[model samples]
Target: MRTNALSTLSFWNTPRIGVARMQSDMAQANQEIVTGRYADVGLALGSRTGLAVGLRQKSAELAALRDSNNAASLRLGTSQAVLKQIQDGADATLTALTGVPEDKRAGVLKDMAANRLGTLTALLNTSAGGQYVFGGTRTAAAPMSTYATSPASPAKTAVDAAFRAAFGLSQDSAGVSAITEGDMAAFLDGPAFQGLFAEASWGTTWSAAGTAPLTNQISLSETVETSASANAPALRKLAMAYVMASELGSANLSAAAQGVLTTRVAGLLGEASKGLITLQADLGRSQAAIAAANTRLESQASLLDAQIMDMEGVDRAEAKTRVDRLSTQVQISYALTAQLRQLSLVNYL
Candidate 1:
């Protein structure tokens, strides 16, 4: 066995090691205090770390679902408001159609219909967050075609062709007076004319929207439609009713013929109003579902947070106590090191 004598180097080295350890403890405790979590999560929880990771992942998923629900609510809420405006317009048009004298009905209703149709087109093209809300799944562009004839819209051209094929005369022709009420009714009821408002024709000429509406997943089990299509029967019928009053020669027809047109227009508009109401109701239900799903998501997130906290959370009071004690110990170690450095044989003498 070899015996080694203690020297100044040995005395200095022992305190240095103790101070280093104290400093390391202080750093870890301070970290735990500031973060309210273990400085090393995997080391603290060991085998339970995987459970904490899974809970955090589930919490993140819940947050994402809430965000999606918010977006869907925006689109659905805006769509419902717009549909109400359209329904109000149709109802008002019906009233105006019946109240006006036959002599003034065609001109007044035509101007009203034209204005209403322009407004309707713009509303149907509404967008939210750069996405077209009424375009169903086709969110990239405006769903409705402009009714302007300067560019010769496909819808306007189709309507003109239908009118010509029915009466052998243009809609604005002076010979429209010879079109009797029965003849006008026959033309309206005819397949060739009614086909203009059919789903296929509307898709080809009037709308750029997809047949399928957009949907969102509010939760793991709940997915609901978040959009309304411009090509819905209500919208098509509403557009056709407006086109007839605005485009066809209602202003040039006989009183009885105008009456026939007014009655038919009123009926179509009424149906459209009902359909619009139904659409609003459907969206209202979806809104309710999203709201309910959000409540559930919040509850689930809260439970996950609690479980994760139990596994990984630091005790703030205990960490603070440890940090204060380590700080005192570190200060004492520094003082002792300074004292040791100042020691000399002359001071002892």
Candidate 2:
């Protein structure tokens, strides 16, 4: 009989514990209903937490891929727009040069070449979001030198020398030539011309894709050539055209000189123009690759999301039912707790 006696404090404490437990369950069910997710995710999926964690990691990776794809898309878009502008400018300049009579072709329309030189160079030195678009991997600095022989561009020094060797005249030495079509073609097609135009001879390249095209990692296992290898064939050919117009126009020109220079340059312009169409398609392919990567990432993300939801998310209707049940039980517990508190020997008096 002595062992069976229970204290009032013990009785009150036992019911109080039950009340606290009910309130905690009520709060958890309410939270699950509001969030559409388990309040205790780890407890709810104790053995399956590994699967949930893996899915979350995959989702994070897909998100990163999306961010990279967006950046690549924007950069490629800017590059495409600027490239079109350069092509159009070249077309207009070539048209103007051709439209004029042969007599005034060189000196008369020289300004067009000069203007184009400035614009095309500006295009080559283009930047997007503080990164040099033409620099390939070397995005911090300009990919090509300025047209001047100043320290800003080392290529100009080599170019000037190459011109002197090819035409037997300095870039600035106002000397006219009967330099024939065959002569121009031979020189342009030779190693000397290659030396002048080749990106390798420029000593330093701003493009990270130096000697190769730029490569971008759009996904975990895949990479694509992003923009065209900095400073395209058309742009270089245009530069040569610009330099010839400005230099040759400065000197006296015979009919033969005009014919030869114009013919050779006209061919270069034509080829450059034709080449651009192909180049544009190549760039489009790179963009298409990025698009493909994004599509794959999106699909993967959907799968991972579903898996994660299965592990961590709650059923909305079921959570609501649980909340209602817990709410009633908590109310009953509160009433019991109150009744227990009211019980006292003095109440009987």
Candidate 3:
């Protein structure tokens, strides 16, 4: 190694090097004391660094699953709540129609069915974290189109066409009073019934749909079907009932005619109520699975936390001791450096 010829320059370099080393050591000790983890992370882990890395990765994986589980749980809960609302709505309409005078049944029944249809549409279009629950991978858009003049609302158009085809006139035709249950049943079972339900005319109103339901992986090799499609049978039944009740509202039907319509609609709503039971149960299963996954992930996270602590954590008492020792050493090094600076050839003389 080449040497500096001047002794003063050499003396200056030595003290600076000593002070720098002491400062580095002191900083490391201070960091360990403040952080509760070894300052020399890489060196401390050494050959075990890979294990610690794997443990941390596992922790992160569990955390990700927990976050997904939280969102999924809420989504499942929302679905269940909506199902209850539908069931209760159907029940209320049925009870009201049964108790009302036959002469006043049409208006009361129409309002109830119309309300049910709108509520169900809103529920089906609900999204979890911005993803539509019933859209079957078409998360960006609502699952149902409104029953209006819009071309996309084939369900509404079909229902209107159905009324014309069945009565040979508008739904408000006074001749509607002459109709029978057979006529209502025919319409209910016919292709014209598609107009009131997006699921019935899925491609037009509820586009990007499929039979395969939405899902999420709850655990390794365990996945859950998260939500049912908009075309669920129960929904279809409700839509049919709602459409009939709504379109029949303006019809100047007689007492017998009102009884036939309301009675048929009440029966259909009852069936829809029954069908929703299965859907609610299915959604509950998904919610339960998410809860179970959350529990397992929490246990796994605790273990990972322990592993990480063993790999990197420092005892607080030990760390404080180390910081105190390094601080004393640093003070001694400063004193020695100052003493050495005074020992030049001229100072010796």
Candidate 4:
């Protein structure tokens, strides 16, 4: 008469809670794998990549500026080297004028003239990577007109005429006057010559003379004056020395004047040699600055590359491991949930 009362039982549902928790854990792992981040998208730790990216962009900009600065510094260094060579040649000319015998003076003068012409050509046609360095942005045209080997020949006359036409100067007007001692010092020490030496232009012109011989290119301006009673120190000295050399070669000057000319030439050479020492120092400093700029640019580029890598580079192994773990966790959660749902009192009996 005892009957077994089987009460309707609720299905075991604890697996549902385990399934939900497993799904949440799997989703979090999947998110980390997809985003390659260990923190939430908008969290503080997640901002590191963005900050690195910004820093990298800024570094790239600085690197570009530094590259431009390096290029400019290199041009300046090249220019300084050219100037130093010119100065050395000038010193050599002074030495030749002062001490060489009268019989040999003409040959030395010719050599000096050739050397000076070479210097002028080098200055005007200065190039870096095949682009003109001193053309002041005019890369197509030669800075100095082609030199004529013979100053008195027809070819020389034509070349001179063409040069004058390009520069808007008349043949007769293109001449440099003899400089006095005071004028010479002033030109060497004054702003006008200083500006010229610095490679600055006088308005639109690259040089002051056109279609004129090198001897006719007086560097000093006309506004400068000298007393009639006293000889202009620098100008007269140069003129007297040049005249004496020419006269000696032509056998026109007295022996006493020739001797004086020789001594004067020596003194000029000594002074020029001293000047070269100063110029070389300047060139050295300019070269050092260029090297420093180049070094800085290279260092900045390296730093920028590192910063960029930090921003976007990925760890492939870690990412793959996270994805595999998430997949396994999801599978395990589904299996457990199914097993829990299957558990029933009737099945147990």
Among the numbered candidates, top TM-score falls to: 1
CA lDDT, candidate 3, residue 328: 81
- Per-residue CA lDDT of model 3 for 62-173, tens digit only, reads 8887887777777777778878888888788878878978778888877667777778778777887877777765667777766544453666666667688777877777
Model 1 vs. true fold: TM: 0.89
Give lDDT tens digits, candidate 1, residues 1-349. Answer: 9998977777777788998998888899898888888989999899988988998998999999999999999999889989999999999998998887766777778889999999999999999888899999999989999986596899899988988888999988989999998999999889988998899988888898998999999997889998899999999999989998888746679988888887788899999999999999999999999999999999998998888889989999999999899888888888888888776787889
Winner of 2 and 4 under TM-score: 2
- Per-residue alpha-carbon lDDT of candidate 2 for residues 262-315, written as tens digits (9 for 90 to 100): 766677677777767676777788799999999989998998888888778888
Cα displacement (angstroms), candidate 2, residue 310, comes to 3.9
RMSD of each: 2.7, 3.9, 3.4, 14.3
Which is the winner by lDDT between candidate 1 and candidate 4?
1
Off by more than 4 A, model 2: 3-16, 148-152, 161-194, 203-209, 217-222, 331-349
**TM-score list, all predictions:** 0.89, 0.79, 0.85, 0.45
Candidate 1, pairs of clashing residues = none
Cα lDDT, model 3, residue 292: 84
TM-score head-to-head 1 vs 2, winner: 1
Instruction: Enumerate residue pairs that collide in model 3.
Output: 155-195, 155-196, 156-195
